[model samples]
Target: MRELDVAKLPEYVEEDVRVSEWSTVRVKHCAYSVPSRLKGKWVRVRIFEDKIEVRFADVIELACERLIGRNLCRIDYRHVIWSLIRKPGGFARYVYREEMFPSLVFREAYDGIQVLQAGTKGDLEYLRILHLAASTMEADVAVALSLLQMAGKAITSDAVKEMIASSSTSIDVPQLVSPAVRLSEYDALLTEVAA
Candidate 1:
């Protein structure tokens, strides 16, 4: 066979797409969410077998698992939470509302918020908590939510933030001391073995 070109053919198919106002790009009939900053911007997408990578100025900006079927969506809360925070009311009827919950704990927290505060107030509170999770560590926020729910405390973004702050401040790292090393013990063991 003749020698291949200097550069090998890319395994992925590349295409240029414009990010929709909702910060999503339609690929293969499926919508994939990108960063909010990419809204209305043209980006290059590298579609591989299992993942799609979005690049701006040849720098990868987003990479996520490719959707398998038509009309499916892969929405990440972090990518859309900022916009939702600005208009919390939209959350109730948002098309991919269920996908907004990053985990069962977050969903439970939202339900708990609803129980404490009804209607739009609860939605805003839940959105705030979600925004906090998107900005900080989700596991930390989840643990704080679990603790508050277990303790029968009000579940609010501020309360979760306080819980996280308290937990972080209370961490006690034990001081470690290195033990002294003695060559004499090893020498005695060696002498005994020789004898």
Candidate 2:
């Protein structure tokens, strides 16, 4: 394979590969998107110096299922764009045009904190709430982070909204909304990729 532009990329890449369950694929070179659903499936790749392709959805599914219940590791799901690269420091970052949430990463990192190493109920509570609220576009992350420090671990979304509605605190929250967000609505994103 030779280096080529986007117009020539498809010619170099092909699709429909398969893998067994509980495995990982080595996408050692280049940058491309993988279907989001391929998160845990092991993928067998046929790559050369210039061109590469992992082009199969089933392969992704198998790998992702293998990773179920595992700690904070990167898994690529069967999303529209399913390309991956093994990054420096061995931290596999799932790169796609969409489904870009760092909160999951943050929660994992938070779990690694020394204080939370033993994993207390309070720690998990604080982390989950902070994680959920942090993903919200209107969430006051600074306040949430501070609240965690104040021993106010987590407030359920229902309670949090009611607090805001009742003006219990200065924090202002709007009406109840869909927990799932549509990618089309993100202003900062230039491309649309589904989770």
Candidate 3:
């Protein structure tokens, strides 16, 4: 038993990979997205059984669930939203376009926006909403979109932003005032106990 190595072996396989211009790394025939800032940079990928950790400059940058099948992709919209916002036309033909929608509400909002403004204009508006979601809290944006849809209001990024701002402003939290603690009462109790 002493001859056996006491140190534990790493369960993950490590590899060095370069981030593509699209901010993705191909691992085991699956594409996993990294942050846009890591584009064209070499990163260390530690592939575990269930997840993969991407590291740059010895610091962990991204951790994604490992894809099981070939030609599969795990694309995070936040990683690519900036470029898509710049070129809204590319959204129509984006290979992983469906992955761009963070949730059903976002998809519905896009459809609604398309109904209001067709072609590239709708795309731009939807991209702006997505950008808002990526930058701000997604749940907040989703709630704003849901509220706008419920009210039968036109769903635009600006409308969602306005809704969010108004809702945030309207929140009323009751102030809690803690009662002053009395040390004299405790002293009296002690005196009574002594007597």
Candidate 4:
């Protein structure tokens, strides 16, 4: 038998797929999130054994690890965050709702919000908190959630927003002192060089 040339094989196979209304592209029976702006648009998907690369207009936009099983999904909260902010009602009933929770702390915050405010109110509140986490540093939001819970305060979106605002440091540029510089010193150096 002749030796097989492994080098000739392509590193990855590319397939064209349309991004669904759900802001996802399906590959091998698995769904992967893409930016919501790409919805209903055709994108090139490069399928590797361990991951998938999504490209739009020849520009690589997202790379996510491949999901192994049928109907499995990998969702990034940032991908659909803006849309969720506009329509927070979908958060609780979204087909891939759990995937939107970035961490256990976020999930806990949602649960706590639900306990405090039931039904769609809680969903909308949690979505706002998710939006805040997406817009700012997630660790900060998580810390705020922990503090709110420990303080026995209502874990609403406005409360989280207030906490985040309070914890952030404000810088007043006018308060900064600038180092003094003397132009006369430069003139003295020039005179010495000429002498």
Candidate 5:
């Protein structure tokens, strides 16, 4: 058997992709979301086995599980939640709306909001909740939703936010104590030197 040179092998393929207006880039015929702030910017996409990593200005922005088939989309709701909060009306027509629901709890929360409110109001409320999940701890949001669901209360965004806030524990700061300095130690050292 012959030995192969390490430098002759290519680790991955790089492609320069322009992030679309929707905050996504096309790679392997599929769309993947980048950070919303990175829209209208060029990103270097590194295609690796089992994942596709997107980088902007040498900093890794995000990585997605590469899709095997064509025309598929992988979206993280957190990546675009802020824009959706500003324009809730766009949810209905958003191409990747289905991917926004990260879990069943979030889906159920959105459904509950829709049942309680009407039209764009419900969408806005759900977007706010999603935004909260994106901004804060998602596990905390899930716990809050669970509590709200058990209480048979409306799962509005404000309710979820309050529940999360109330459930969080406040940290106590400890007072600093300065150690006393003894001048006698220095005097003893001077006396020993003089002797």
Candidate 6:
């Protein structure tokens, strides 16, 4: 029998996380409908053991980790992301403008990411953020994740840009997370950015 570490996959990556014997799953292939903004930035998680690894297009060469439980993730990022971008009243996208420039935003969650959470409540919220972010190329969650990866802290897209410019590592720019997420999901975004 085989198993997956559900601990690594955060919310917003998929609708739900189903842990089962690895042999029970058909790993033939899986694909996600990501937003245009995230074209070159999309990746899929796969479990290798106790830890999870993130890779470009589910390919092993781009593997970002070699741990456990990372493979178990959401199939679609659109569902959750749409929920956040839809606005508080269930309509309209929140737009923040910098002088003539404008960008959208998305929130992480109230509880936090799976790894940071104590149980399902917190994990679910993070899952929501991850799923939402993964669904689209332009979600605020994407930028938030990118920021979390580099800055070692959570902040808005605009703030992330500032950090990236300052880092000077010349590493991969996480991704363009335009339009800050609505509400104060900043804390949540930061918390779940890694897992």
What Cα-based lDDT does every candidate model obtain? 0.92, 0.38, 0.92, 0.88, 0.88, 0.37
RMSD of 2: 16.6
Q: By the lDDT metric, which is better: model 1 or model 6? A: 1
The runs of at least 3 residues in candidate 3 whose Cα sits more than 4 Å from the true structure, single-residue gaps closed, are: 1-9, 183-195
TM-scores of all predicted structures: 0.83, 0.29, 0.86, 0.82, 0.81, 0.23
List runs of model 1 lying over 4 Å from the truth: 1-10, 173-195
Q: Could you give candidate 4's per-residue lDDT for residues 63-136 as a string of tens digits?
A: 87888999988888888988987887877789889997888888888888889888888888888888888889
Q: What is the lDDT of candidate 2?
A: 0.38
Give a tens-digit lDDT track for model 6, residues 1-195.
Answer: 789656854432322222221101212133222232333443454554333444444443222223223333223333224443333332122221011011233333222233454454443444344444354333444555555745555333334444445543556777877986576687778879967
Local error of candidate 5 at residue 35 (angstroms): 0.3
Pairs clashing in candidate 1? none
Q: Model 2: what TM-score? A: 0.29
> Backbone collision count in every prediction?
0, 32, 0, 0, 0, 31
Candidate 5 lDDT, tens digit per residue, 1-195? 998766755667899999998899999899999889999999999998688899998999997788888999988888888788999899988899999888888888888888999779999988888899999998899888878988999888888888887777555678999999999999999999999
Q: Which ranges of candidate 6 are over 4 A from the true structure? A: 1-112, 134-140, 154-195
Runs in model 5 deviating more than 4 A are: 1-9, 170-195
**Decreasing TM-score order of the candidates:** 3, 1, 4, 5, 2, 6
Total backbone collisions, model 5: 0
Go through the candidates in order and give the C-alpha RMSD of each one to the true structure.
4.8, 16.6, 3.2, 3.9, 4.4, 22.9
How high is the lDDT of residue 83 in model 4?
91
Q: Which candidate leads in lDDT?
A: 1
- Ten contiguous residues minimizing lDDT sum, candidate 4: 167-176
Question: Which window of ten consecutive residues has the lowest lDDT sum in model 2?
Answer: 81-90
